[model samples]
Target: MFDWRELLLRNQPQASQTDDTTLKMLEEQLLDLLPPIVSALNAIANLPIEPTWFQSEIAQKFKLMLEGVEQQYLVAWNHVRNAQIQKLEEEYRIWYQAQLRSDKSLYRTYCQWQDLLIQQHAQGWFSWILLGLKEHPFPASELKKGHSFAPETELLLAEFFRCAKPLIQTDTYAVLKNFYSFQAIFTHQSPFLPQLVQGISNSSEKEISEKLEDNEFVEAAKIFWDILIVEN
Candidate 1:
């Protein structure tokens, strides 16, 4: 039988200062920690059946060692995992705020461009008529008007979209998408702003982002709850 205690002692590293680096190192170590025990178990299974007391005693010792190692590793790993998650959640919040600010700026710029175009180009009654057709508010061929505003506005929009593309492609976007998925969850009579604030506060922005981008929603609600409900 394999010396499980000896294997664990040989593989375990010396204690280090507590930090993300230490946690990461511990996580890596834990991943490989149990494989030797598994191999030993496999080896024992392959051996010819023996009802011998010595063989039974060895098997019992291996079981106890495996349990002890598992318990220790799990406790250590959970501590690291929670810390890493919290760090990620903080990062997500920052990213989310920046994203909101960027989107708001782009919308404001678009609205200003539209208002300026209407003021300069549309006459009294014509402007009213144009406004009435909200679905097609922008004049056809307005881009061809040779106006400086049109070119300037186009450039602004182009730059906005270019900068916004990377953000939309991220995991953070996924969390946002999920949050918005059920409109009724935060719609009229639901006190949207408070809920929104709470959700943002509780959310593990980075984790949600990753899960969303991967199109995985199975655990999304739980994470969302952690951020918005549990954490808050």
Candidate 2:
């Protein structure tokens, strides 16, 4: 684990150091912290399975650590640069806000990537069922009210559902909203299918509402999956 406190302590100013030296030391410490934090996060992401809370928890910690480093830098700057305290604080505030936004954007991208992995796995199950290698490979409990399968199929379906349950929630509206927002920013980005985007644009709220009301969950899942892949 990366120890933010250890890094801070290691980089603390020496009593005999001049103001310029202290300022330079603080700047160097701030630069050094970024690489180690990024490397640790990358290692964490490569784990086969992460605890559900780990990413968010680490993100929060990283943010706090960066804020602490920035505060230390500002203190050094005040001692060495003779800048007005109010102006310096305001400048740091603006820079911190921008940095925080950048960090949030990176976290959101990580989450979106994780969702893509889950959707890809779900799509593999869809492909397996379509090939008749499995008959009804989703749980009866999760299916439409009248739907049922053989005992063996039910067993397989139950196991599969247990593994996929976390990713099974309906996200059509959310996916579409993300897709449009992303498209707005990256207008020239290649789409999975232009026709698909047009079709979604043409779809009405009532049609989507009916699909959810009628328990057409598989169709809804496919729509959400399509939007995810296309936007990716």
**Number of colliding residue pairs in model 2:** 0
Q: What is the RMSD of candidate 1?
A: 27.2
lDDT for every model? 0.40, 0.43
| Residue-level lDDT for 117 in candidate 2 | 41
Q: How do the predictions measure up, each by TM-score?
A: 0.22, 0.25
Tens digit of per-residue lDDT, candidate 1, span 107-208: 233334334443432133233222322212233233223332243233322322222223445444432433333222322223244456446633466565
Off by over 4 Å in 2: 12-96, 99-105, 114-121, 124-232
Point out where model 1 deviates above 4 Å.
Answer: 1-24, 46-51, 54-57, 81-232
**Predicted model with the maximum TM-score:** 2
